[model samples]
Target chain A: MIEQVADPLPQTGFAKVVLELEVNNHPGVMSHICNLFARRAFNMEGILCMPVAGGERSRIWLLVFEDQRLEQMIRQLEKLEDVLAVRRHGAEHEVFERLEDFFH
Target chain B: MMQMTGAQLIVRLLERQGVRTIAGIPGGAILPLYDALGGSELIHHVLARHEQGAGFMAQGMARASGQPAVCFASSGPGATNLVTAIADAFLDSIPMVAITGQVPLSMIGTDAFQEVDIYGITVPITKHNFLVRSVEELLTVIPDAFRIAMSGRPGPVLVDVPKDVQNQLISFTDFPPRVVSDSLPPVDAEAIEEAARLINEAEQPVLYLGGGVVHSGASALAVTLAEQACMPTTMTLMGLGAMPVDHPLSIGMLGMHGARYTNFVLEEADVLVCVGARFDDRAVGKAAQFCPRAKIVHIDVDPSELHKIKRAHVAIHADVGSALEALLPRIRKSMRKRWLSHVDSLRSRFPMQLPGMDDPRTHYGLVRAVAAALDDDAIITTDVGQHQMWVAQAYPFRRPRQWMTSGGLGTMGFGVPTAMGAALAEPDRTVVCFSGDGSLMMNVQEFATLAEENLNVKIVLMNNSSLGLVYQQQNLFYGKRVFASKYGAGPDFIKIAEGFGIGAVDLDQAANPRAALAQALQTPGPCLIHASIDREQFVYPMVPPGAANTEMIGG
Candidate 1:
């Protein structure tokens, strides 16, 4: 199956995921990252965009899908006017910090 | 250029969401939300007689049509008045979004005029709450709050947007898409496999369906499972149409007010495969002794509910539809002959049967006739008491969410307001409320709201001269002591309703009963039909607390 090959995907059952952006300085760069996430519900959680490094251009983290047209994703990000390196992490695999029983 | 204020942005968003009507009475604290409304062409605000009545009005709209209803209130007393309606929506899982304008940010901790910690108070009763502090942030949180309140497991959501933030100007482009954690608790494969095994092994399996079937839109899936497994199914009060009354596999309602056969079948089942139903105290009286003969395979969306009641032989934390869908393909086709025969025998032995119409003139007779005439499309609401039981016992509900009353927390005086909510939600449908005398008097002030709106609702009062349920308890358990149950000075209900300028009547005989009821139905606006009944009548087939199904009492 394609799911097993050349892939990494967030195991969430949701068909789509959208990442909210909160960039400070580089609106154009953040827009590019959002564009990358908008193409398809890839092998990774789906869409990802957030202000990189407190919204500064130096902190450019191109949110890319782990198995999303990866070759195409990397090529697209690398070709960006302000090109940045990329890293992949599973969305659902985060360690839960705590759960507070604060039901008032 | 500075963008519009948060209040302005909200009105436009609501318009996009098709929220044409809102119910609320504005005050000092919530003026910004009302002020923003001054220029908007989209939203129409209904000036309520009272904040509590407004809350019920919003609820009525939501229950009427499953569309999320909006309500607004100011801080302090305004917010406090909205509490019961919010709690009502919480228990019933109605899609409602309530916005409370808080005091200025500077005035918050100081308890400025009319300020209260509305968010903290509503945390338990609401699915979610937000204390929005900034205008720029409101552009994002406002739509998210509305979507959250209406999506997933729908319930009431309270958004306390502060007055200062509402008035602040902000440059806004468009609202952001909702940000939800991608993490999802996967369905345990082993648990699902074991559940499949136990279901396959049991000969006398009873599929106990609940509201989750309706919640997940799994009626078709549930029916498939029932047919494949060849098991008889029964529903809780909330689970009425999950399995239709006419289905041969469906044995109607269960528990205290359930049909005789439903209790009988449940008492004798070898395996009880429950779906999406928390074994509430009313459903499982004296939990320790409930269905002692069977193994409980509990399936609920909330994981906390598995061992919260009776121990489950196989506990599954998955959507009932998902679980059943997974298991249905693997289920075998052979029917359990002995078990089927046993359930059939029990059903035949104690089928739900009303007392034969002796005079054709009693309260029960009227209820049966009205229910028959209505033909299952009319919505029925009840105030908690003998009348509530009578309607539940007599009326045949063919649709889920058709009969909306206070189910889990049987709040008295809930009938009229809830009926108002249902009528608001479904303006086209005939909303009928069967209220007890004691319960009707709690929020009788809503009569003016009913008359003002002239909503198409049929209000039927079972005017027994006392708190009928309390009277029943006094008669049954309190050594037959005649207590504070009767009213020497009965307020003329006909005059009270007529005072509100609504069509009103009192039913006394059979020849005129049909004509009066038909006339009431034919009238264009709200009708208050009061039927005086003898206070001594008690609901039958009631299994006393801690008693088994067979130990039923009364007629």
Candidate 2:
């Protein structure tokens, strides 16, 4: 049975890893990334997305745990037609952390 | 430049993408698009009773031919109905293009009649979605939709076109050929060498194959790797047909409801080489405990799978076929005789035994009868239930794509329309659908479509008079308080088929169900075999929810 797990990913890890993606700005690109993780039952701790300067592309920052699959996930992200480049960051990456602080 | 309506451009682009058929039901909102489609000789539109059936039919074609299949739906309820099928396609990695008509660009979000934000609703389900605001945007969007649907772990893509856009007259300058630049990045040589080193070093290794192996067309390469390395192999449910079921080194399916021996072998494995598979929770219960001793070497086309559950000692992010091809040359040839013998002993200790294999009145017998009746080349589609699980356990699927089921979504009512889709995709080959009574009723309306089109789909209904899977789950967990699961002696499926002008055989009264099934199989054009099975019969070797694979019950 290969359906997406409705259950949220177990909340335990704190060492956050951030992946910055530059992708073609379209309705479904974000869904593709979210769905991919959802299928694997992986959780995205945080997400930040906005249109780039030309409105032709989007920049997405995905917050996740520092899991082993991170490198491979980046490789898969690079494969999408909408996704142009992916860059990684360590726990100190402020996008999600700052958002969490602001919410707090 | 030729002036044409947006609807005309959409149909023209579909023709360029080599789409010959589309499954859909026209509604008031989508009239413009349907109007354009009405005159197009390039595409044949199969009118489905429900939008969901249309979606699944497209899925069946996609799964059969490995090409992007198209489905159409109008706004609101029509678009919502297609969601389940779209989600199914996404989870299963089926390449599908679902085109839904919006009310109009101006009317969107105004709570217009039959208008819904289909693009927004489909965000989590589709690989990508588009809401075409203007006619000109379609020129690039339509072709891009096809390209996205077919490339890199193919999945469903949606295009929500408003009525205004479809009717708008626009000058079209260029219809560029759909180009998918699928240049896979170079494989990591160091990773390959490391994986080869681990393979050569491990004494008790197991080769684990997943759906990706089948998706990448690396089954032959997988077999070669297994034989050369003398590694015992086990498949995930999705990876059932990755290796021929009878291969000596093939250890059968693993995880929940997996072969008892196969799970034991996995427990004992020193090194696990997983290709084209994510270590799903169902497959590897208690992820940390699974293959604890094994140094996992995971090779897959999708990067998200590696270390998602079990951390890999070496992870290669490349297509399964290419990864295996590169690693095959680097690894040494040696037989793990002791490991093979250990696996053999495990197999002998807990061999698979389906109850009533000899009796034609039972579920196993029905499964066996259908398998025996159909030709080896027949494509089998199944709905979600006990029947589906039983089919997985008993069916001797020889190759990939031969066995198509909703693995990820576990969607019911998938069998009938998908079988029709498969039959339509490969008109020469026979298509068989194994459905339970509960699942069959979900999209029972499609039976008419099957009859009208005269599709070469033979449906074998396992009428147990209950939601067998739900009933089984209730028995296991809810203390047998069967709630809303039991459908007592439902409608006569044979009569229903006859109503649709399709041929049918009732095996309930037949003295020999196997013979009756064989007769039904040979019957021409859209037939149904109604086989009544014991409601109490349960699928065996079921691992309780969250239980380890080794802790399965009732084999």
Number of the predicted model whose DockQ against the real structure is largest:
2
Docking class of 2: acceptable
Clashes of each: 5, 5
Q: Write the per-residue lDDT of candidate 1 for residues B430-500, one digit (tens) a residue.
A: 88888988988877888888888788888888888898888887787678897898778889998999998
* DockQ for candidate 2, C-alpha atoms: 0.23
Give the TM-score (vs. native) of candidate 2.
0.91
TM-scores, one per candidate: 0.79, 0.91
Model 1: how far residue B308 lies from native, Å = 1.3
Docking class of 1: incorrect
Residue B407 CA displacement from its true place in model 2, Å? 0.6
Each candidate: RMSD: 12.6, 3.6
In candidate 2 the C-alpha lDDT for residue B479 amounts to 82
